[model samples]
Target: MQSQPHVPGFTIRLADAEGGQEQEGAPKATRGFRRRRRNRHGRGLRGELMLPNLPGFRSRSERFDDMVLDSAERLQDMWGKQLDGVLFAVDEIPPNLEQLVAEGTAAPMGSCTPGGRGEAPMVTVYRRVVEQTATGREELQDLVHDVVVEYTAEMLGVPPETLDPVYRRRYQ
Candidate 1:
């Protein structure tokens, strides 16, 4: 048995016939380059964070975050399957969402990687900025819709005559 110098929780061990990841009597390896799969609803080991208690109170920040995520997903759902049909740019352009999925980046947006680009152009609502600007969820939703619609309209090369009436009123 050989151990490397000054490295924590790393060791080389003989493989077992059963092929278990753990080596009998060997110290467990620390987390290395890994890509964990998050379950649907965005919950998984990677979700193990102590979020601020919203308990009965959906604070402006929480609402903003939820709405931004929901709207972003919906935008993609409405158009992403078509490939490059909709462009979703966050504060800045995110890397290829398809590639991020393959590479295992859980929250690519948070990582500052643009969400999508191709078809209709999209402007992502920044959670931090939206929350800062909004007084509640309803407000945040409007803001996100406004930004998206505006960006989409620009890409459409139209005067937004086709935009949802609600968004037109809320944003314009």
Candidate 2:
């Protein structure tokens, strides 16, 4: 007798009729078994099973949103109360700026808005632009951190290096 590997949820038995070898003149009808597929649920052409959504399965936009939030959190930790009044936002694209448009300035990965009339200062990061510019995941992460640092610096009227001392070291 030959050994068969154990398979979970399935049972196997040897056929004593032919002893796992084809007969020289076996009938074609007895070669294989045919049965219509059926289940407790409705049945027709029951195709491949669809997998349920699992944890860690995030959409592209959702992942980008998380990256933006994470960068903001890192900045808040670094700058402390200095970032309390600033609002961080992530959008698919940057808003059209009439002045910049008239000047023919290209689209930016991020932009900082100064507040007025009871509004708080805002930092806006453009998701599509940044994602398109990065060559890979690591590059995307670095670019995102750089954009956030740049925007925070702009909001605080300081240079990017001053915002985070280790900022330039990340790229190197």
lDDT of each residue in 1-172, candidate 2, tens digit only: 1121342222122121122346779765532111335543646545534333654455577677667767776776667767766666677776665566698887799878887797667777888889989999888988888898998899899988988887868666
RMSD of 1: 18.7
Would you list the C-alpha lDDT of every candidate in the order shown? 0.45, 0.68
lDDT of 1 by residue, 1-172 (tens): 1333344433322222122246679897654222346555666566524354645444444444455445545444444433232334344223365686688864222221123343232344344444456577577677776665555555555554454445558644
Candidate 1 residue pairs in clash (backbone atoms < 3 Å): 84-118, 84-119, 85-119, 85-120, 93-114, 94-113, 94-114, 95-114
Candidate 2 segments whose C-alpha is farther than 4 A from its true place: 1-56, 97-105
* Candidate 2 similarity to native, TM-score: 0.62
Q: Mark the regions of model 1 whose C-alpha exceeds 4 Å error after superposition.
A: 1-66, 72-84, 92-122, 170-172
Clashes of 1: 8
Pick out the ten consecutive residues of candidate 1 with the lowest summed lDDT: 11-20
